[model samples]
Target: MSFDKIRDPRKIRHQIGDMECDYIYTAGVAGERFYIALRDEEKLLATRCEKCNITFMPPRLYCDNCFTELASFMEVPSKGVIESYTITYFDRDGQALPEPEILAFVKIDKTDGGLIHRIGEIKPESLKIGSKVTAVFEAKKERKGALTDIKYFKPA
Candidate 1:
């Protein structure tokens, strides 16, 4: 659904830690391969469909477009603008997340790909259709092959 208006982070901060990170843990397709670019190396990559000239961000092992097993990778930018977005307040368990967490279809720059990650350091209302943002990653030495590897994106 949709919120009537964006909820204020300040008010929600009272319930959640204002400076805390929302630790996320989830299973993904070909997560092992992606972790290389995400944690061990701070890189943005997509799986390139050699046959169709299409790339899948959050890289895929197989292309649904042509249903071929993709084998090569294309390194791209972690930067992009919001193609579309929604402010969500739910955790993976369907419990409300600390209100105002942004769920966005971030269109990664320089390629036809994107990553859906949390948007931090901005008010929900201030976000727009094309707001520019950059990826903020956790220190590689501490990364453990998880979504928490890249903390979130914020005002670039």
Candidate 2:
């Protein structure tokens, strides 16, 4: 039966058993390059759109403004200022965490965009909107091509 003609609720068929499915996700061209730099070189990469004169963190393949292909990739300083932040006392499951975790949206120097990551090495009371922070990466031996590769951002 075609779903296009369906009008009655009783005509719908339902399955109760769980469906098994598996999938893998790739970061795509621009993201792959970004991750590689972050993992292998411990560098923060940003893509610039010459047309719009805008730089994007977590680099993009194209510019959102001019729709120009972003061919220029550059390393942005790992240090940045906290534009905004929050302290979460509960975990993802809503359970109370032993210690509150600080998360911030940091505007990296010389870039139009920034990264949102956990802020560490400082008390929540001390954090401010303009606080200077730096990315703390995982040890070289433990580096991985993922956002988690950055342990957290700390006061610089």
Candidate 3:
């Protein structure tokens, strides 16, 4: 068996990984209405299942348990606990970042799934496992539909 990435400049994808395939993946524009409460509004959005009344943070289109359409979107505050975290030294492509990074799993203030954001202010060696953190967002004029619209989490 040979273990080598493509050695041709003609190939669009010069490397392949576990989920890599011969296809291009892209997403359409994220509608502004869907994130108004989260970015423009500086709040969280989670859908509640009409059938089971189950609320989820970072709102989904369907409920995990009832398989019902999660249509009731609610606003969740920007507060929560740092349930877990890891000091990252790599980028999305797994290469070492110029500086070490702190990634934390923050359980949304009042939801089931946790929000993953970079924990700011605290150093990699100083992050506490169960510490508290809050979401911080950029100014409204600079806001976008992306996650970065909310700045890194800081001590609350």
lDDT of 2 by residue, 1-156 (tens): 568787765577765577899988999999999989999998999999877888898799999998888887899898899999999999999999999999999999999989999999999988899989999999988987999899999999
Number of residue pairs clashing in candidate 1, backbone atoms closer than 3 angstroms, sequence gap of 3 or more or interchain? 2
Q: Please report the candidate that would top lDDT against the real structure.
A: 2
| Per-residue lDDT of model 1, residues 1-156, tens digit only | 554465775643256546767876555656667876777788877888868877787788898888998877778887899888888777778897656688788888876778788898889878888999998988767887776787888878
The whole-model lDDT of each prediction reads: 0.79, 0.91, 0.75
lDDT of 3 at 92: 85
What's the true lDDT of residue 86 in model 3? 88
Deviating ranges (above 4 Å) for candidate 3: 1-34, 50-53, 92-96
Alpha carbon RMSD to native, model 2: 6.0
Best by TM-score: 2
- How does candidate 2 score on lDDT? 0.91
Any runs in candidate 1 off by more than 4 Å, and if so which? Answer: 1-29, 89-99
What is candidate 3's lDDT per residue for 38-77, written digit by digit as tens? 6667877766665675567667777778776554567777
Better of 1 and 3 by TM-score: 3
RMSD of each: 11.9, 6.0, 5.9
